[model samples]
Target: MSLRWRITLAIALVSTLVALALSLTVHFAYAYRQAEQARQLQTQRLELALEEYDRTGQPGLRSQLNDPKLPDRLREAASEGGTAAMVTQTPQGAVVWAALSTTGGDTLSLRSSYQPQLDDRASLDRVLLMGAAALIATGTGAGVVIGARLSRRLRHAAAAAARVADGDYSTRVSAAVGGRSRDEAAELAQAVDAMSSALQNRLQAERQVTADIAHELRTPLTGLTTAAELLPEGRSTELVRGRIAVLRDLVEDVLEVARLDTATELPELSDIAVGDFVTRRVATYSSEPEVRVATETVVATDPRRLERVLANLVSNAYNHGRPPVVVEVDGPRVRVRDHGPGFPDEVLAEGPGRFRKGSGGGHGLGLTIAVGQARVLGARLSFTNADADGGAVAVLELPVSEGEDAPGR
Candidate 1:
């Protein structure tokens, strides 16, 4: 069940228990008071009957002399020379009785039917029952309203948290209207906002450091590349040039990573056919992969960024996986699979992280860069191992164009 319904049910259960307890208390108290009043009236009638019998030697109306039906307890009290009264339940209904001993060694008794008071009690019970039901309904309704408001606030906070988790550090949750006063939902929103702000600041500082270091090295690295190129042609010089080229490439990758971290670059979107785009990009590779076009889907995306993402995937597969690599385009979805050892468990679980190289190892920035570019294009990139074939498969799903149906449609 949702939080809203759980809270509503909890409130309703408590209301029901309280209504039952209060109804029982009111019902019993009212019944007790009625019985007391009946007993008092019966006692007064018995006393008048005793007075009339002593003067005229005859019982009064509805009064009995030496009544055989009187209860033993009432008879014992009357024999002690004092008036006594009691209310008892009978087959017909409740009955109130009173008795008194006369000077002639006889007991005078009186009784009245308590059915009328019982009828009044039944009416009161009906009213109390209806009142209790109304109370429960009112309480349940209030719970629904309150639960809905709280659930909405929580949902907003959760959405903001989800955006932050998806790398949109700028996302923040708005606080409640009345600045946090014992409202846990408002406090939760404030906490999410604070966490987002902290992460954004930390990431910005790290990106700045990375950009600064890459920029500082680029000048000296360029000078070294020029000087090395001027050297005489030999095995040693070629080795020097090769190392310099590798270093330059590393520097450029670092800079690109820093730029992606900032999330400030916007995509240059254009309409492109999925099959043609994949085929052309795969052809540019020195070792081309087998390409299969399964759909003629068209999408709006940045060709440059899409190529970057695809290049990274293909390169990673080649470097870490075995041939024959296959790139399949199905609608807006592209899958690159290489028959080799699948991705490590950690990589599959956490996706790619910079500087975390795999067993076949380069600097491990290839997949990380791919993920960043995919994010920029508003696409989804996922990694998985093939079920039947033991190979790593990278799936990239691009966003469909506006006013266009998805692949199946």
Candidate 2:
């Protein structure tokens, strides 16, 4: 059940228990008081009967002389020259009896019908039941109101947290103005806002450091590249050129990551067919991958960014995975699969991190760049191992514009 319903039911259960306890108490108390009053009235009638019998040698009207139906306990008490009263339940109803010993050695007994008191008690019970029902109903309604308010506040906090997770650092949760006293929901909202602020600052600092380092190296890197290019043609010189190229590429990847982190690279959205785009990009690779088009689907996205993402995936697959790489385009979804060892457990779990290379080594920035570019293009990219084929697959799903017909629609 949702938190709202749970809270509502909890309040309703408490209300039910309280109402039941109160109803029982009032029912028993009222019955006891009525019994007591009946006993008192019976005792008064017995006293008057005894007075009349002593003066006129005859019991008063409606009073019995040595009544056989009198309770044994009352009769025994009267025989001992003591007055006693008791209310006993009979087949008819409750009967309150009073008895005493007269001068003639006769037991004087009087009783009053308790049916009226019982009737009143029944009426009371009905009222109490109705009142308890009303109380519970009112409590349930109040619970619904309280639960809705709490649920709404919690939803606001959750939404803000989601936005923060999605890299919207400006999103913050705050309690509503004139809301109820500072509660847990308010505390949660405040905590989310604080966490977002801290995370935003930390990410900004990391991006700044990455950008600064990349900028500082770029000048020396250009000079070195120019000088290396001028250094003849030999195996040793080729090796030097290869190492320099790798270093330059690493610097460029870092710069790209910094730009992505700072959200400075925005997508230039345009209509593109997924099949054609994948085929064209795959042709540009050093070792061309097999391209398969299941259905030609068009999507609105940044073709340049999408190509960059696809390039990284294809490159990563070639460098780290066994050939022959395959790129499949199905509707707006593109899947690049390489027949090699799947991604590492950590990579699959927490995604690719910069400088964190896998078993088959590369700078590890390929997948990271792909993920960043996918995010900029508002696309969903996921990495997984093919269950049957036992190879790594990177899937990128680009969002189609609204009102546009899907493939085969």
Best by lDDT: 1
Best by TM-score: 2
Q: Which pairs in model 1 have colliding backbones? A: none
- C-alpha lDDT (0 to 100) for residue 232 of candidate 2: 92
Local distance difference test, each candidate: 0.88, 0.87
Question: All candidates: CA RMSD in angstroms?
Answer: 2.3, 1.8
Question: Runs in model 1 with CA error above 4 Å?
Answer: 167-170, 175-182, 403-409
Judge candidate 2 against the unseen true structure and give its global Cα lDDT, from 0 to 1.
0.87
Native-referenced Cα lDDT, model 1: 0.88
What stretches of model 2 exceed 4 Å from their correct place?
175-180, 403-405
Q: In model 2, which residue pairs have backbone atoms overlapping below 3 Å? A: none
